[model samples]
Target chain A: MPGDDGLRSRFPISFRFLDRSRTVAPPGWSRWLVPPAALSVHLAIGQAYAWSVFKPPLESALGLSGTASALPFQLGIVMLGLSAAFGGTLVERNGPRWAMFVSMTCFSSGFLLSALGVATRQYWLVVLGYGFVGGIGLGIGYISPVSTLIKWFPDRPGMATGIAIMGFGGGALIASPWSAAMLESFGAGAGGIATTFLVHGVIYALFMSMGVLLVRVPPDGWLPRGWTPARAAVRPLVTTADVSARNAIRTPQFWCLWVVLCCNVTAGIGILEKAAPMIRDFFAGTATPVAAGAAAGFVALLSLANMTGRIVWSSTSDLIGRKNVYRLYLGAGALLYLAIALAGDASKPLFIVAALGILSFYGGGFATVPAYLKDLFGTYQVGAIHGRLLTAWSTAGVLGPLIVNAVADAQEAAGRSGPALYTTSLYIMIALLVGGFTANELIRPVHPRFHEPAAGAPAAGRPLTTEGRQS
Target chain B: MTTEDPAATGPHPTGETTGETTGRTAGGGRAVLMAVGWTWVGVPFAYGVWELVRKVAQLFAG
Candidate 1:
């Protein structure tokens, strides 16, 4: 058949195994296996969050300024957005195994390069290696499994995606302590840092290989045992039709979602980036001042909430519908931010609860988006659409920290302390969340003009689903 | 076409019990692979969660 044989003709024998046709799951090959494959990559790449574990050590050991030390992570975020936006289409064309392989190579090799840079004290090389190279791995690894999981678990795309994405949230949880221990063992000097990076590169490469070896695309038209398209079609936003990633971008629905994601992420990340100091500052003037260790614990709590939210809220979206869940995220999220801004240290428990709520919404926003894309655009190139959407994350990554840190720095310069330090930033987050809530409200069903023509219909816009393209 | 070729057969008939039970009926080897796959990812994830939980405990203790 052309599906299998055509790929063989295009690629050399050695590389042909990476083709889409090569990864098709065999009959009755359980779809459950795909999530673990995806998790392996996500868990490995998620180490990006633990970049801070190395930041202090990098600064002290290399005698660099704090801002200089942050360059590698900042560059990596930019690369992640850039690569995901640009490489998304290529990823769709290549399939999951190929993308995972590329991700594993770039991510691990990026770490190795950082090790080389650190060992030689060439900081630019570290930025290039970890930020530029590893960032590409992050972007590709992120979206690699999204479309496949949606395809495999059409019955539970939200939960399926949440399973993989929760790994991303949880990745740092594993890396932070592990990296700290490694740094402790090796000492925090240049030699130790280089060795730590080298070990991370090697270990992550081996761990990510599991994803490459195990990932398989569901066979065309493969549905879960009892589910049918009609069941899904009952939801107004859920479409039985497919839309190309190209056409999806042109639609207002995509842009609305872009704004929604950007705002939601900005709000959540502002607090997350400032969690430790923010909490301490909030209670600084109170009778019960938060200690340094307690602040670290608070940061850990937010991470837990972020990881847990990915799974719980996303799975809830399966029952309540994506729109309603996002309504809760944006609507209720804005209120929580407002609560923090106004209440401040008046109630410590309230402050912690509200911040955790916002963090959970942040993680949920990341996890639930691919499934939301599937609902709006169909599964044809949902991963690519998701890839495109993640530019919003990159934008918010910069915007969130800039808003909080800039404001806090200014407040401190003005001699402000306690809750006053972050009040302006908290209010800004509330406004952003309200904006996100408006954007979420504006989201409507995507116009059918963008939908790919059904098989055997007039070849109007683009090819139909992945199944149609493959056949 | 190969027996595994899904395009050849198209969508399975609705109400067919082909997914979960098929894995069970595939016998011990496939089940063993499933166990190994989940454990490989699960163990590290569990450890991370445990470590974080310990850290979070310091918050209440403080």
Candidate 2:
């Protein structure tokens, strides 16, 4: 009878009791459940990485130039950052369910509209459907599950996020093959691309809904078993106060991180956007003729590295601490770019390793950033801050490709050959990474003025009122 | 499942129920809606795969 009571008490159907016991709850709602919810949104929105797949088709079908065809994808990324920044507070307020639902609706509709545009032979329709409308979905869906996972596994925030963020990277892995098959089956003209878009809208809408339905916030005050507030508070990395999303924008830390994210992303994407061309240039003089097939494999391998680094490197941050982890990312990333600039076609292995390393940092930057926010600001409103920080990504989305393409275009016009096209771009990325490294070093603890007073506890730190002015 | 267990006293877990598992009783509509919800999640992911493959092939072809 006594044992029964204990068993009943421990395993009470109502999660309310589990909160009180505060001991480790038997892996609350299968950890398995968390990944699917994250994957649903990430995998669906990940279509961004595969945007190049449509680039060729759109250019030919619309008789548009490369830059013109790229406009939609570029605009969609811009929208992603803007929407995520503006909608972040809304996402936090409404909960993941509402956020994901909206994402599904917008993203899917974007596709459906693109289909119509394709059927009608109107390029603007494709842009409106895929770029503007769907971009809203990409932004919203991207951050929808972040706060929830942090809430669920306060113990392992980095790994929890890595699982979902990795899905974003992997989405391309799945989509590249599948989209090709559909394009082949349907034909790669405007009609074929449009059909693919329609199918993507319908399908992603369906997939993302699972996350909306399954996600549940932990009851307030629920901490993992064996975890205590005192211990959680004591970590040198943890900040206890909540920063209003508005005020977060005013802080130097926010801008510094913005620069950090933008620079890191711009550096990586500059290479990624021009992966095949960069490789071709590197191997141009070799007898082997870097086959187009091998170049494609190189891209896929880069994706794998990107996805794997998100999980592996970010999870490692949990051990090394967020700031230190970023030091590695930026500091080493600059060196990698330098290696590429110096190596320039002479050594294939060095080139591959350097490129892969840079791409890994690119992905690591995304995955590690949320945890960094959690460390600097408390979990109080990290999702919103994160959403705000993503504006940098939108900026980088434009800047990264622009720098690479414009530079390459100019170099090609000058009849440059054999890695000269990218040398300047690589040096620019190195400067950007160095700047980011400096910003990382400048990040000290959140100023005392920013600390939120604990309930019924006297505030311990100096007020932050004057700190923002100093910056 | 009486509510006397001291452990149950913390802030109410969002979806906790103190009573017996109300065996297959309520919210059939909600359940169906959830099932439909999951379907929405799968379609995009499937499409993403299709798109990824097509692009990789083109990269190779060119």
Candidate 3:
């Protein structure tokens, strides 16, 4: 009876049971071990961002239209959201090790399938393989380390999550140049692309295996050195009660954040998907003709900005607070997009700076949201909630490209040129950013109805009569 | 008896609880494996990407 009471006392909320049952590391083990475990998975699956590097080759080799070539990347994004949302609860139940292992399998297999598709000239296979299967990996791998890292570094959740999230951004830095070289060596034809896919499958599988093997949950009753519940308890960001993943979806905060994330992503990805073409169009009539290689470099530079922003801006959130940081991202991001629209390609420097700024905020939005969720929903079932929220991302993945591409394609058909094509699209992104900013402003403290009462309290004020006890 | 005294407990006389020891070892193993494993995993991935880039450049040049 005492042992049962002790265990119950240790976890005031049902969701905290997951945290309570964890296995804590020994005294001698360094905390530094956590990042690599995170990086291993992140670095491998982060290849999703680098898909653009393959766009040129795929376009030339398959003789596919631009929109046609984008299907794989766009669909992969769609799948990433779907898989993450659907798999989140399972991920939380099974633990990071299980989730990451599954991620590695799906992602690598996706590559293998895509390789076969390319070899056989079956374009649909590439979409099914990379977009559907590999996307499942992206979603799972993305969230696998989140709950674990938050648990391991409760004292510094933002910093811990930032380190792992940074890998997602940095993944492209390595993948871009490497993918280009693979295309060069093997030839960018179907055969060459196939070989590259084969290499990606084998390499990422091996890399991600490290994360699967190394991940561990902290032991019950273990707190980070020099920290306590009492200290963490007072912060407005800390949640004393746990919300089940199911009840979490019912909360207004969840939907509000969902809208925020979706709109923010839509705005950023609009420019990103069309960065190369947009740059060329912006400078076409000007004396300064943007060369193809230079435009490619511009895309690469935007990628660097995106990746670095994940680390720099998100880590900065720990100091300024999540809501405040997002204010900068959404608010300033709208202004930047407006600048690009209004500047009319007259000032190349302004265009580049604005584009980079928007991309940075885009990447920062991803890296910061996990920590933001931690602040709102207690870590009890955060991975699951994070997963559900990713449905928004899936929506944006499709929506962003469609808006940019459809608008541009339409404009081209209408015989527009020299910055005219993207003007309407830029305005749309600005509008989405404005909508996101409004949602961020609307986020209020979660109603008490959502909180699970502390253990031993009479459940009089229970939020939902049925799930209230569980919350 | 003092709450701190393991001998005073009515259960097994062993000084250490099974949970305590198991937790320690498992945590330690995970830490070591994670650090060393990531290094091993990262190296090959880095090399693979490097190889891909080298090849792509060659294709363009030749």
Q: Give the C-alpha interface root-mean-square deviation per candidate.
A: 7.1, 8.1, 11.2
TM-scores of all candidate predictions against the true structure: 0.93, 0.83, 0.81
RMSD after Cα superposition, model 1: 4.1
True-contact fraction for model 1?
Answer: 0.44
**All candidates' lDDT scores?**
0.87, 0.75, 0.77
Task: Judge the docking of candidate 3 as incorrect, acceptable, medium or high.
Answer: incorrect
Rank order (by TM-score, best first): 1, 2, 3
Once superposed on the true structure, which residue ranges of model 2 sit more than 4 Å away at CA?
A1-28, A60-63, A189-191, A232-235, A287-289, A413-415, A461-471, B1-10, B13-62
Each prediction's DockQ against the real complex: 0.30, 0.17, 0.09
Ranking by lDDT: 1, 3, 2
As for TM-score, the candidate ahead, 1 or 3, is 1
lDDT by residue (tens digit), candidate 2, A114-211: 89988898889889988999899999989988877776666678888997898888777767677777888988888888888888888777777777
In model 3, what lDDT does residue A78 have? 81
Please give, as one word, the docking class of candidate 1: acceptable
TM-score of 1: 0.93
lDDT of 2: 0.75
Q: Model 1, which residues run further than 4 Å from truth?
A: A1-9, A459-470, B1-26
